[model samples]
Target: MMISRKLVYVASLSLGLSLLASTAMAKVEMNAMCFMKQSESTAHAFNPTKEEIADSSILKKNPTNVTDADVDAKFRIASLSKVITTDWAIAKLGPEYRFKTKIYVTPGTKAGNCNLHIEGDMDPYMGREMLTRIFTQLKPKLTAQSCKYIETFSYDQYFPVYLDAMKHQTNHDLGWEDPARYFNSTKTKNDLAAFLKVKSGLKGDFSNIGVVTKDRYQEYLKGVPSKVYSVKSRPLFMIAKDMNKYSYNYPPNVLFEKLGGAEAYKKFAADRLKLDGEDVEMYNGSGYPAMIDGKKMYNLVSCSALVHIMQDLDKTLEAYKGTRKFQMADVMAVGGPGESYSTFKGLYAGGTYDNTMVAKTGSADKAITFGGMLSTADGDMYFAVLTSPETYGGADTTKARVIIRELVQTLAERQKLKKFEYKQIGDMNATDDQSTLVEEPKQTPAGSLK
Candidate 1:
């Protein structure tokens, strides 16, 4: 009996040590893979830095030959900046926060000349159909009062002016000839007038509508502006879904404005994320236009800093998943075969990463970036890959995407060996069974934006 017990103990100890050795080997492999080769053309300029953290321990880091300054160096994260903007908005405003547009009516001196004020709360997704609904709700009241003509029609001047400046700045940076592409304040007002006219059966075009100056905006505040009706935008999470999925610029730009412009946004992120002043910097919500004033001034964030932010975002989202109908995957683009906004779907779809990676991708002339959480058998792993401008140029994102995939796949494989229970946040639609995998969720219809 003593000899049998000794044999069993020896076997168990050998198995434990083997597992540890395997884990250590996997870590070494991952560390080696993280060091990407620099391009010959710009080998001098190429500076690649990556950091991966799992369970509060650094799994892989390539800091050799790269100084602390290089590790801390900020690269233009491109659309990855959207992750920061959307994450910040979600934290500050909650996932369910909605933008409100209010309609006010006041008696006019003449029989058919009452003033109508449409106050906008910077709702970026407000569309013609939504305006029609607002007008439809207020039609009965207006018709009952015999209000045939709108004597003075005005909207919030502050937001329109700010939007104009933002549009101009974006156009200037992109060298876009048509500033109207970004935003046309006049067109928006006119569209609102047309929609309201059709819905309310009112007469005349916006020529009859008056523009409210900053000074005139206060007059409506003197007397209680009789509220006729109002419309609330879709929840912030839904907006975030479209923003990250499509890499839409307007929504995030407007959101940053709502958060009190770029400078204020930086301060807010620094305070909330506990990041140093140099750790995060963003001129615009989107990281396009890699330069400003001859110097490349794109949104700069270190890999580790972004990974930490992503981890915090994951925790914040977990708190809401149980109570809310939407999940983090619903807001972020997922990898797979179907119509996903995941830029990596072309390369990673139908592969091992399908439905397992929920991330954001950013690319421009000088920088390529990707950062998000990867669900593994052990647990969730937060990762961010930032390639210096020298690594990619002109339409070639293949190298970056390929490297990211290999690294993630290696990590997943290592986790699988541990036999750790697979736990994932939200519904990632992941599966170990090869036969069960399907395409990603279809794109949300335009009407659903409401």
Candidate 2:
């Protein structure tokens, strides 16, 4: 009996040390060498496109939850919202709805000496470079039209939504962090001008918003004078292209308005998806400008829903080639013989690099998300991940992104990670078979963001 007990103790101790040593080895390889091994993590996501062949290997575990779809916050996803906005806009307005900065001249307007009431619909065009290009292309037209001189100019964001105080009540408002002013598209009208009055200042429906206050926009625009020069945005598809490629913000905000109706955000996604769910719902279309009461926190869903949305729209998982709106590829940035910032190669900036990736990444407050199709050597696979902290992490962005990157790569080359017995690991999704392996688990955690 004593000898049997001793043998059992020795086996348990050996297994425990082996697990610790494996995790340590994985971490050390990353710092000491150019390679990184899986941390013996057994987490995985169900690849709907592939069959899971039952097999057993040296089952390892990831230090972090890489294959878990834990997104559940309704915070500002920043640029990530741009793609969804773009997707909806293209579907609604078609490719003809060019988001251009139209230089409308009320029959007679000039360059220097005329009533240049600069106008914008709060559209996602009117960028500095776009303005320069438009001017360059229309220079001959302007010259032929006999443009005259003007001493001063006044600009106005025609759409009053640009004047909104962000339903959110964070102090980030006073700063230039508002998506309206932060991105290239959807810049404030008269943004080029150093001095101009904000035409759309007050909300029309200041009181109860359940109806009663119709024609709100016309009421708001009633103050603008008759003579107005306008600029149309680039094609909606073009703007959408930029939004998706670079993850712009204000562009997506404007999109929710264009696709879901002007004031529809008051109803949130219910007005868009028009479907009820087992999870919480949201009122803001872009999910950014949520009210402060935390009422929108329940808005959540599974990766499968997102996949269906894309499929229904025919946003297929195909590579983007040719002269794309944006282009990105990796190049070796040398520090010392291979001591670079992220040797994974290339600037993480968005673009149609080789036209092989169609994805979106999201981050706001304490939440981070990434969803899309990666055209890997093995083939294409759709992945979505969400991380919601109890509170937003103000400064530790690196930690969040690192986690996102780990999740992305883990799903990208799942074969690299060994498999283990499935256990009740999280709060999102679980099934009857506790020992069955899963590729991706849907769970929510109250982890500290910092």
Candidate 3:
């Protein structure tokens, strides 16, 4: 068939624009091009088509933009990686892998001067209620009464110090120390208790449910753990929800640590997705501390990747029917016209007096960070945005927010489209075999839904 003139014209125009964009972008140190598309899960697995693709590496008019042969440019993903990682975990491990911070008394249970071994399987926002549950459970029974905490404390005891769930720091020597470290309690055990107290607005002389200052003394049990020990932490889905809503860093990192260690997941991602060691760089899991360029820097992803992952998570809505009410997407963070103001983004970002977006975000080494999903006010779409590596330019997260908002705007616009910039977006070679099994609520294919 003879080439159509209309087709030729559009291709030429896009090529010219992409080339121009490349030239302009290269002037900025390093570069990379990656377009994200909404993903649909097929019976066999998942595939993201190109019509869903949106790009930032180049304008739409480059003369020599990459042909289908060049989809391998190292696109930096930043916190956009959170959704990718989280969804992968859910898909692989099943959604039932929700976090549970459990409190246990050391075997042969002892009181004062005796240890209360607590194991928090990585829940960041798991503040006071969970703590109160532990205290309340052990309340009438905890044997420690008027005992003294040893002065020599291991500083590393207090930790929300997770970098990536699936990975760990090569070195465990954290520099500065926290007073909470003295609690060796690091707050999860007691800080959690205090936070619960504040949350319940519990009445008088109930003063010291969970409090630890310079000194932590043991006392007889009086608190109730079960009245407070109620809900399964908002669910991993909700945790991801809140992460995006707040654009908070700590939780995303914690989730990564909780879901799987960073190192292990990287291996999982590589095996599952078949990642080339050089195609992407995996550091500290989140965006900061590293970057990517056109040559192929996968240090992390961007706001674009974040939204695409949300699209995948949205597909699983049929599973959470019994637990959650649908949440609003991160409208502001997603970046369409008044996306934040008119949609769920604001709710999650603390937009309205009520309602909220829930998602995970990450920021490290002064690098700007982003992650979070938005459910619009209309309640149909979910938008998630994540950004990183711009600490090289923009100021704090405010600038990152603008970039994230734009990324969301672009991706959501793609969601509204019918045609493509003209190409397929994923690589068949892109499967993640390194996946570890994740348990869930008996999953069916995405197609099983209406």
Candidate 4:
């Protein structure tokens, strides 16, 4: 008896599906084993529920604690908060937004002495090199005036106020121990002054350098004096990249203050991302809040909430990519086996998973978290994992890295079994591979400037 063509096609389809199901079952088992190893009753682990970005379908999840790993359970995200802060900044401030510092000269009665006023716009990355650049631009003007000594160097008073606010907001008491030293404004100012003195052959030392009073500051803003030059910060993405790559606390804290603090950022996230307010709690943008009663009061965000935020951020980034050279990978830290600014750089670099993982890592006394995107041959998957203090016994970054590596490997293997190609979000290759070796450039010393 001759079988119909339709019957033959149906038979082939049945066999294909059976093989697919068998492979999927094997993946589930592997994920379960991986989760069990981490779950060992010692740590509370919130593993990833991998999904296809194209269709938002769950590709794989830990089989053991599917119910325990409540997607909405709040976990302290530590430095992972940088991811949210950076994305919010990109959305609200725009990726190209540059902080500005306006320079003004109040001509002095003394031939060699002049008062130099620096009106800061909170350029977080303002540093010695940037100062050199700004001063170089101002050198010709200073020479034209025959300026020899900077008798008085003043900055916007708001700079210190903002820094103080960050200290208070993050409950960083250590920030005040030597506000002058910690802020490093005085040193920066001295450095700038020294740089100018040497460059211009000035004789006298920079005598009076401090914050401008409100009354005096107003006059300068009204164009009473000569405006000399202005220097702009690097693009916001560059700053955000450093914030995530090194888990730097100050940049995000400053950004948080610019947004009007914790409550403000929460409202912004809720309204813009459509996230539930209760699911997202942030006391500071840096995710390094003061501890209370032996527990950290860091930012709290659910794994599910974080994953959703990442998805929304990816969409925003994709939209921006159409008009400019911007992508989420351009801002967030890349992990897994490369000379990149990754928390896991030394541990995972040149390993089996090298160049496949891009993530932000967070660690506080009470928790450690990892959230970002993982790229596989099938596609990119956004994920978040939270390990509680009670579970891990403390913030064990080494353990966290190991688990995250295993988790990513499991998801990649699972994706292989499904044979589903996920749409890539951004260029995974666009990373600063050298960031692993060198530390992020320190901000201009705020105290030194004072």
In terms of lDDT, which candidate is strongest? Answer: 4
Query: Of 2 and 4, which scores higher on TM-score?
Result: 4
Model 4, stretches more than 4 Å misplaced?
1-69, 158-207, 213-216, 220-223, 291-296, 321-323, 335-338, 347-356, 376-380, 390-397, 416-450
For model 2 the local lDDT of residue 253 reads 59
lDDT of 2 at 202: 16
Per-prediction backbone clash count: 0, 36, 88, 19
- What TM-score goes with each of the models? 0.67, 0.48, 0.47, 0.66
Ranking by TM-score: 1, 4, 2, 3
Model 4 local distance difference test score: 0.54
Question: Regarding TM-score, does 1 or 3 come out ahead?
Answer: 1
The TM-score of predicted model 3 comes to 0.47
Return the TM-score for candidate 1, rounded to 2 decimals: 0.67
Better of 1 and 3 by lDDT: 1
| Each model's lDDT | 0.53, 0.35, 0.35, 0.54
Residue 1 lDDT (model 2): 6
For every candidate in turn, the CA RMSD to the true structure comes to: 14.2, 18.3, 15.0, 12.9
Q: After superposition, how far is residue 125 of candidate 4 from its true place, in Å?
A: 1.2
